[model samples]
Target: MKLLLFVSLLAAAYAHGDCGGDCLKACRSCTCDLPNDGPSTDDGESPFQIGNKYSGDCKQLICKDHNASLIVDGKIYDRLVCFQGAWHFGYPEFLEEASSAMCLNPGNRTCPDDAEMRYEDDFKCMCKPDFEDMSDVFPDAPEDILPLCTNCGKKKLRITFLIDNSGSMASVIHEIKHFIGQLVKFLKVSETGNNIAVVSSAFSYDVLINWGEQSHDESAIHDAVDSIDADGQSYLATGLEAVKAALVQPTDENTQHKLVVFTDGSIKCGPEALKSLARAANNLEHLKVETFVVATNSRYTTRLHAIANGVEDNVFSISSEEDDEMENLKVAAKLQRRICA
Candidate 1:
């Protein structure tokens, strides 16, 4: 009877004002103070209560489940919220209980056993990374749950480089060599086994090096690249045709096929055939093509753009106006975003 009466009194106190109305019962020991309540509109919403969790709203991927909540060390926190992908902080209304839950304690090692803090572009943790942002294919429908990345086993990702070795590329071969070296480094860190191949075109075309399968022979790839010297004409169509034919042939469904082409000139060998080959390669369900042109010149851009399956994001036209080092760095950064994201 005494225990029951004590519980009743504690519940009453909890209902009144446990932590000065700033936090839920679970975060009572948290030391951070709430931001200013500011002004409340007639609708009963205020800056202090709504928004202000992160700098702005999350963009890129929407949350699968917004109503989800989690209990950590006896405290409740919002588990899932939608990201509008607008790159701002204008999220729709969230549960009132989620306000204090966003302010996590960095020092406390009391995160839930199943979840880890999510870092955004700002690298701060107001969200959990486990919640995946779905592709924009479904604009209107939101999913009930976000799928988590599985580490069930290692997968294979096949990367093919269609390098331009024309006479005009002599000036930029040094930059290209550095870029490939960096690419090897990036792939080395990936969770999957990566297979690297090189196909170059000049007055003639040749597969400089082929390890047969996805091999971790970084030194071999580097050696093949080192052996390449710019001396022939750019025959882009021939290279694309060869790549398209190879991609359509039988291969493992588990292997992801990616073709990255580096060029600076037009297809001197065949123009019409290049278009057909590019369209065919893009249409291949198993292949993704990303092309980089060394010239910002409109003529070069148009040619590379067409060869990139008409996707602007996949076509990177580096301007000759900038220093070679700077341009290569930019290309490396952009590739990191696409490949690592």
Candidate 2:
């Protein structure tokens, strides 16, 4: 019985010794050289102590009974044994590579080669401009898993705005500008890789901004909008043709096109001219250019709907009461959803 007791004690000693000298050394030194701020303890202690945990960095460390353990994204680094006072797998080169790897959330998955990890509200893996997200295909997969992505070859978007700068629009021009400004903020034009153009439609059409001219310059785009002086008759056909020409400019074959028209309707043109506008709008449909219209006047809802390929939801109506800042904000939000969808 004494021999049996002695053997059991020897096994206990071996189990404790398994923690190794490096782990004990790491615990004693308590060095955590992570990218973010210096190490912090969960209990708000200045110096780390046993039962203390260092978190919020690339890697996590916890000092336990005379030993230290490395963790990442709630997963213990079982294979990474402590060296000196740092966590390392094997060689110094391997340690460097591991340190550089990004820690993504949902499931702490590594981003794909063609993707990059971005932080907005949380960490997200965004596919490169030329790649498409394939996460929808794996609906049953855990949310923590990294998204699957594939190269899309070429991805380009061209959006054109046709604003009716007619004599009648002068009353609500400020509301139109507000909507445009809010849309620009939501779109993040510079980051989305989209080219933007603006056309002012009066008796004649004016290309206020050309595609790819102010694509990345939000301030310049706003300046162009501010320069709009509402006057002349509303020539819808002229603006439609101008938009068509701008969208047809040479671009990638896979380029997606969008057209947004801000008008109070009140087309001063005759029936033949209106028919011509309808035909031009139809031509854009044939080219697969998504179209939307915002009617500043509720009375012109029918006219705006007709311009929007006869799609009722594609036309947004802003009543006189709804021209205020708060109301225009709601309208812009709805418009953003449709355009993005």
Clashes of each: 11, 2
Q: Least lDDT summed over 10 consecutive residues: which range in candidate 1?
A: 144-153
Per-model CA lDDT versus the true structure: 0.49, 0.62
lDDT of 1 by residue, 1-341 (tens): 64564464345334433333333223322322332212233454422231223422221112222322232222433332212211112223321222322222234333222235442321222224432222132233222211122211133556677787888888877667776775565454232466777888776678865546324577878888888898877777677666656642466556566677777755564656566646654655335444433343456666677666667777665544424544554455456345434
Across 161-209, the per-residue lDDT of candidate 2 in tens digits comes to: 8899999999988778877886765444653566678889999998888
Clash count in backbone of candidate 1 = 11
Residue 218 Cα positional deviation in candidate 1, in Å, after optimal superposition: 1.5
User: Could you tell me how far off, in angstroms, the CA of residue 273 lies in candidate 2 after the best superposition?
Assistant: 1.9
Instruction: List runs of model 1 lying over 4 Å from the truth.
Output: 1-155, 189-192, 246-248, 269-298, 319-327
Question: How high is the lDDT of residue 90 in model 2?
Answer: 36
Q: How much lDDT does candidate 2 score?
A: 0.62
